[model samples]
Target chain A: MNFDFTDDQQAIKRTAHDFLADRLKPDKRRELAEAGSYDDGFWNEIAELGWPGIFIEEDHGGQGLGAVELVILQEELGYALAPTPFFSNAAAGFLIQQAGSDEQKERWLPGIASGEARGTVGVVSNGEAVLVPDADSAAVIVLVDGESASAVEAGSAEVESRDTIDSTRRFSRVSANGGGEQLGGDVQAGLDRAEIALAAELVGISQWALETAVAYAKERKQFDRPIGAYQAVAHRCAQMMLETEGARSAVYYAGWTADNEPDTTPLAASMAKAYAADAGWRVTASSLQVHGGIGFTWEHDLHFFLKRARTDGHLLGSARSHRDRVAELAGLSRAAATA
Target chain B: MDLTLSPQEQAFRDELREWLEKNNPGQEPSGEQDMFKFRREWQKTLHDAGYAGLSWPKEYGGRGATLIEQAIFNEEMARQKAPGLANVLGLVMGGPVVIAHGTPEQKERFLTPILSAEEIWCQGFSEPESGSDLASLKTRAVKSNGGWNITGQKVWTTYAHEAKWCMLVARTDPDAPKHKGLTYFLMDMEQEGVQVRPLVQITGESEFNEIFMEDAYVPDENVVGEPGQGWNVAITTLMNERAGLAFGSAVAVKLALGDLMDLVRERGLEEDPIIRQRVGQLYIEAETLRLNAYRGLTSQMKHGIPGPEGSLPKWQWSDINQALTELAMDIRGPEAPTVDERWTYRFLRARANSIEGGTTEILKNIIAERVLGLPRMR
Candidate 1:
């Protein structure tokens, strides 16, 4: 059993890494984040790269890949903390593709895949979705609330822009009010895929935070030698490595299960979401601790990552909610019944 | 990436599973000596089936299985709750070191007996003074006629009383640096001037012993590698001790977690949200450990040697096992302090999981210095 990516997958990852590194410099990301808006130029460039359609089927005017490939791009975007509509658009695509009717797929999949008419997805509770990313600009918005989802044309729904601590991407409070078409397919399957996608982004964010901490530890000296020489600092960095790597393992395995092992996806997706949600916050917070007072300032790029990690932990599903699901899926219910 | 086993691997697993199903010896008896004898017989059975030394080279009387195959072997054995081989130290560490660095004569003399369980082995690297800093060990070996005279103390030597050979490391050059003056030797444990005393642990068990060697003689041919290079040889043994064990340990943790879940249900605490959260966290950690191990294995298969990432699974395993046992006790409620036998023994024994092979602190140091490229404290 090989746990590494295939040659083609490796090439996709390297390409994404180099492309993001070149296009989304720290200053560029800071400019967009500070401006509280995304650059249409950057979104168009990513769309030209066909990343928005990386996992969409070729029949729908897309590249026809799998969840693994989609995660590769999402991870790179998270690492760069790039401000784009990629994730929201992709989330909508996954839901429509997996849970929509044939007519809904035909109408929305092509536009979502081409990145011309982007879509966004949000979880609804009590008829309102409080945190729908990119909803203001989405061509279509998919709102899901337990077992059922509805797709609404952006103009037909109410979308009020909301500012989150994570300004790298935009969010909105949405309400469709019975104005959209119902997606009557496997909604949980779509939600599971979306959870795995979020988990991958968290892995990327954790990796970035870990690398930033290690670099800072090696360069920042105190009382004579680099602070890393002290176990107090070094052990924190080590703990960051452990959490980041563990989240990574969980996310990658979940992505693979989504593509190859359908029956295991529900359990695997919740595990990934649960582990990565906690790990993202913990690793980034630990990295901030490693940088001391500087990490606390707005001038440092580390805060952006820390904020993104915190916000991401609450999006789609919180760690506690996913852990509850994991308990049920992993045989807690079965054990209780047997007892 | 494909997580499923290949056809050949599946076939290998099927064959081994069938064999085990037919010849499973079940559990060992109580008492230390009885368990040791039972394991020895089990090892003999494994040797006859060509299962002992599964990862050693074919030229050295082994099956020469691939790393994945060896991992599968470990996973299957642990899955079946099979008794461990009596010559574990010999097969995993001693024979591998000899095969990697021994002369033809040394290999011929040492390989077969270890597989057959005719000559059990124990390790002598740690001392009371040299627990974490193994290079500072005071065990000394001096030149003699056709042999070397060893004198010093070694603690935490498992199975020392039953072992026929001790894979000993001694300072051969007193004038050299602490790490450079060492030599690796296979000392005969039956010789005079050698003593083994059981060291009772917190669990009131003497699974480990202290070895006292006052001028114990080891013939010149007993050295596994060149003189004064014992540090590197010992490193090889430590690496072997860590490699490929993750899969087995992961399976064992999974089994323990299953039992804990059973206990949780049996205690009527399954409806407790806090208990459920704890169980869920343990389950996730256990899975993370297993997945990380597979990633490490893939890296090792590509790079020939495992990267510093190998430390991750060991650290994770210790935490998971400890947390799991503690949760079991918590579920046991007011009866936790009483001797419930299985859970109590496991709860006490798991305290050593982090301290035994390598302390969690030392593991963190390794990951920080080696994996994360942090500066060394020294």
Candidate 2:
């Protein structure tokens, strides 16, 4: 009957938050961003620490936590923009764990939890062009063509990740041939799980962005006023703060519903994903807007959140798209999740 | 989200549900029935049976249970489609105000009967002059003797006809700040100078009233709080009022759906995509509202009594209701132009759903400025 965290869940969240904050080095983040690549050593450390595997079975080379735990761990990682293909891999791993057959889980689960296998769900691509994140970094790409699942390996990097607005987390287009196995499972199932997870990720990203913006507003002063003291800046940031919190609660409940097997769960995912995309986009835009002139500059890292947020909004699906799916689930029948 | 009730909360809900079922007189066949009176006696029964004031302090003769238990009580009552209570103002608004800011005497004198429906309460804030611009209210309460002499006109005072007491807000010092110079009082609606005029609505019913006060005497002891701090006390009532009990709104839409579908089948339009699409849209809108309700409920459980995010659900609900009823009217065709007791009446009546509590435009502004972080009007 816990709509939220038990004390044990809260404690795990606290530990995870503290662990990442304590372990992440600003210098390391700078090194990875500057190099325009991930630090494999950092990836190994994350895997060995079992942060990414919080929900993966221990036998699958991971920790055996749950959906809630994954949400907490991703939150900390997102706070730091720790250069890892986490949102992708964890989302993919959890989706497979929920909907995949034993053959499918055996094929990719261990590698993903062990950090040896990197995974990302590719929703729309023609192999000629792609808008997926970290396609270059990913080892196995879970591709969805509306309602089917397949693994496409990006063997040749013909597609390029153009100059992106978000400098911190990288996004790229994918064009690969001689690809991988086309697995079988419910594509919407994977999409729904990924949708719920992405919504939760947006919650993390939105919160960090709002908190950072608020802190920045307080610390950065103008006209002898903590710009936050000015109703103009303060209220906008306040809305961002509120929307972030509201979206977080919605996303958490979606995750909670997934964990609990509630009677009507698709609406939870739809509501979360729709709200996450809508709120993530808004808060990120507000974040950039609040930073003003400096925020407009490339030198300001504030643009990082904006880029990732915009990309995440459309990653699995946009809010409108998810909402339409919600309409289908809620209006028509509950066969989508089961189907 | 694991929203199952605890054993005791479940038991409490079972008991409440059982009682409501035995007593529940599904809405009367006649539109002109006295629901308020029926509901009042029922509430008195609840009070006597010890189910009222679930989260209030025991000092106020409440059960003094946890907020979760109160929430369970609300959800259960809402689910059962129980008769609306006449003491809503007393239970949801005035009692909370009295408990929080009322003197010990006020609590002892007001709380017990209010819960028992012995004294129905009505709010007096929205006036002919002030609505959303509430701080600009001109209701005047002049200092006189050991108390005050009030003279004001208040509109949209819901259920004032049935109420014996009114929660009044008046300007104590208009010369002070717009919000600061106010006083809140417990007014006697039956006083010599207090008059309540029915405000007829599109529903063709005086669901609320416009009350005029000329030299209405209110003793100092009846003041909800310090004289000039009335706005603060008023806000306490408003906040609790907004903490929310909106659930199962889909039921009304469900009734509408049943009626509409009967009409659809009668018109032989079941196969029509146009008709189907309208029903589908209405169904989806109703479903979306429910999902939004769940979203709000889940948040309330996590974050406590909903912040301004509460504005989002109310705003969305109004939109859905307006859109649904409008579409239903369109589906009813030229017959919609004709008003009757069937779907036409409901369509006409549901229009007020957007106006009551708050207007849709005002709600959107709240969503934009409060929830969406748009700039406030300068």
Candidate 3:
């Protein structure tokens, strides 16, 4: 009945937290975000930690950790608001590992796992993936359309850089034009795992926003005392805490479901993604509200988090879409016969 | 993180589930007295099975279940929709308080009756004037004849009419501070000076009552702790009220959600996109509440003290339950206002969830001041 991390999982979380805090400090993150580029050296340093392969199979030249460990790393990445290709690469890894054929896995899993030749995944809509993160830099790209997915080498696809409000991560519009190998196994399973990962990231962003808001509320004074002493401000901060913790619980449960309870992963993942998508944006925006004018400016790091949260909310699926899926999975069928 | 029940926990749950399946008294008859009688009988059945006071120590005639087992017991009860025990307040708060703070003689006199449902208990903490700021209660207990005479008005007391004992908190010392001057007493409710009047709620049923105590007598032996230390003892009772209830409440929400989905389908509104989204959101919120409760339980087990995070599930549960009932009404559409017993009753009753147990505002304040270390509004 324990819902806490094991000793080993706790160690992984602590290590990731410390490493990200040291490696992707505010200055370094801001530098990369402003430049609209990731530092290759920084990416290499993360690769050295084996996080890129955190959930890939050991036989495929990677660490055979579960989704829980991947969630820990993604949460830290989101908290640091680091500018890297980690999420995109991991999304690709999940797709290829879960849905790729034996031969395809042999060809690409090693590269995706080792971090030497990375991959990215995007949801294809109307023959084009409109918001593919790190598509231009990936060695391979997995384009998912409904139940099916395909792996296309970067050179075989048309990748155009797309500037987004979140400059911390790069995005590209990708079109493979039927020039890729189709993944043969369960694509929705991989997508569910990816959604859980994204949800974990949102949880991290939410936690950061909540902490930032609480700290600011305590230190900032208005009229006679700290604004936090006022219920108006304090309750807003408390609501943020509620949402953040709720999102965290959902995401962690989804991650555990992915690793252990396969049958429940789809519903669990959608619940996580839906709750977190709303919570991530709401908490960050609330934090900005708490900061007043300072949070609105580009100079404050809070904007970066806010933008990232908004971008993440729409990346895999918006809250509305995932919620729609949840309704279907939960037996709210549109078919009249069922009703 | 392992969310699955352990082997022992699973066995315990299975045993209780089987027992409930066999001994389950299907449903309570409608009238308040009839329901109370039904529940009293059910509690007797549970006591015979050693299920009542399952969390109390073995020496006190309990199973001495671990926290997880107690949580399982709660979740299963809510899941099976089992009839609630007649001595809920006694089992949850009074028995635990007596065990923690009572004298040996007090334990011998109190604990067994609470388990057997021979004596039911009700709390007397909230007054009309001191609902949230409980320490400022005007309830006065004047010492005389090796006992005390209490006089005050207490509101929002559940089971007051049927209760044999009142876990009353009153001011025993007028000169001391508001918090320090209070004392906890096990006041006899059958006395001539004590009176209970039903407080009709929005649901038009009196699940709660306003207790009027005029010169209510309590022997000095009935004091659970030293006089002037009732505040701390009362805090223990409040903590007990909050603990081990999250799991049950979460399950209850899920069950209500299931009923809501059924209503949606029965009305052929399941296909409506707006209804679907609302239902989906409710499902997500329910899951979040359940998971957060599990996370809280794990942390409490590890730390041996529930943290401020404990405030979250109650707050979240209130929101989810209220939203769920409102959605049910919305799904009912033109039929929403029509008196449909179950859903209509639930819709009106849910308004008190955020206010009762602890208001959502107070919970937010606790999270802000205690959990986040924000400045207190004081």
Candidate 4:
């Protein structure tokens, strides 16, 4: 079995990489983060590129691609640490496409797919959805609570803007008292695919952090030699590689499983999410450690990656929560608990 | 990227599956000699079916299977819980090394017996003083009338007592550099000066042995490669040991994890949050190990050599296996230290997983220095 990407997939990856490199340059990201707002014009350019609808069906006015293609774009965006509403928008699209009824699809899929009407997703807790990313800008917001999901119009929900440690993206707190229509299909399937997307983003963050750390280790000198000459520093970088690669493999496999083997998606996606959430935070923190004093400062771009990784680790679901899901899906069946 | 087998690969797998279903040799009996004999006969059955040395070249009496087929064979064997062949070292390392480096005479005399398990092989690379730093091994050999006379001590030599030949590396020149002076020799183990003493490990099992060679005879024809080239030859065998073996080990860990879940259910400990979390962590680690191995295989196929991550699967396997056993023991709780047979033996055996093939420290060093381009610690 070959794990290497196909020619088409490789072309998508290369195009995304070069495009993000030019569009999401470090200065642009820093400029947006400092302004505490993303460039709406630049986001329209991304939407025009059809990234938000990369996984949507052709019947729904979008590219009839799969989760693998969506993951490739998300990974590049994560690597650039771009200040955009891509993930939030994609999360809403996934839930609607996977769980929406015929009427629901007809009503919202076209707008969401064409990027004319952006959407966001948040987990509902006690009738309030916290950390609903880009909710202020999204037209439709899907709030999931347990097995059921509801789609609320932004005006109908109490969308209070909230700022987090990660300035790379905006978030909001939303409250809806049965304000929106309930989705009638399998919400868990949609959530699992969403988790795989998040895992892929984490893989990208970890890769970036690891490359930054390794490059730093080779140049930073201590006691008349590169710090990398010492096993302590070298081994730290090595461990980062292990974690990053593990996350990457898991994410890639999960993405493929979501597209090709829906039955295996829950377990594979949980494993990917759990492993990558931990890896993302750990590798970014380790890179910060390798950079020493400079990494801790706001002047360096490393802090942005570290903050985004930590925030992403807690987004959608924490690593511990997904790990518990892994426990259940991976043969420690819930039936055993009751028995 | 396709994770499923192609039509040809599926056909190959189905054929092998049918053969195994009909000719499966169940399990081995208890006694050491009986077990060895049972495995030897099993190897003969496999050899007759063209499964033994499945990856060896057709010129060397092999099926000339592709690397993916070899991986499938390994995975299927592990998945079926099939008995291991007696001449594992011969089929995996020794025979491959001979095919890669041996003379025509050596190939003619060695390949067939190894496949049929008529002549079992054991490696003699690790000495008492040369574990990780193998180049420092001081096993000396001097030229005699027609061959070399070798004197050395080799530890952790599995199957030393039963092996007919030892893939021995020895110093041929004392004055040369540590890495340059060595030679690779296929030493006959039946000579007068050779002795094998079983080393009982922590599990109270004699799975490995220490061999003392006081001028053991090695005729000139037994040398696999030329003199002053043992390091390179030994490295080839070591690389073979690491490559293509990960798929098998990953499957084995997965099987153990399944057993662990069964135990968790049986003991009604599945509801315990701590045990569930531990099991979940182990599951993630195990799946990641499997995925990483597939990625590594892809890189190897593309580059014609394993990439830096090739050092990874073994390290991940050791960690995941150890954690799985530890969690099983924790679930056992008060019964952890008791002689519960399977779990206890596994828990203790897993302690050597990290130390056996290569230490975790050495693996990290390899990754840091070779893979990441870090300066050497020294």
Per-residue alpha-carbon lDDT of model 2 for B190-263, expressed as tens digits? 98989989999877777788999999999889998888898899888876765545554545555556567667
Interface RMSD of each: 1.2, 7.0, 0.9, 1.0
A1-339 per-residue lDDT for model 3 (tens digits): 889899999999999899989888899899999999999998888888888999999989789999999999999889989898999999999999999988999899888888999999999999999999999999999999989999999799999999999999999999998899999999999998999888899989999999999998999988989989999999999999999999989999999999999999999999999999999999999999999999999899999999999999998889999999899888787765353
Best by DockQ: 3
**Model 2, position B8: C-alpha lDDT score:** 86
Estimated TM-score for each candidate:
0.99, 0.80, 0.99, 0.98
**RMSD for each of the candidates:** 1.1, 5.3, 1.0, 1.3
Name every residue pair that clashes in candidate 2.
none
Locate the minimum summed-lDDT window of 10 residues in model 3 chain B. Answer: B302-311
Candidate 2 vs candidate 4, DockQ winner: 4
True contacts kept of each: 0.75, 0.16, 0.86, 0.81
Candidate 4 structure lDDT: 0.90
Candidate 1 per-residue C-alpha lDDT over B189-287 given as tens digits, one digit per residue, 9 for 90 to 100: 998989999999999999999999999999999998999999999999998998868999999999998999889878877778898899989899999
**DockQ values of all predictions:** 0.78, 0.16, 0.86, 0.81
1 versus 4: better DockQ goes to: 4
* Candidate 3 residue lDDT tens string, B26-67: 888999999999999999999999999988999999999998
For candidate 2, the per-residue lDDT at A144 reads 64
User: What TM-score results for chain B in every one of the models?
Assistant: 0.99, 0.90, 0.98, 0.98
- Scanning candidate 2 chain B in windows of ten residues, the lowest lDDT window is B369-378
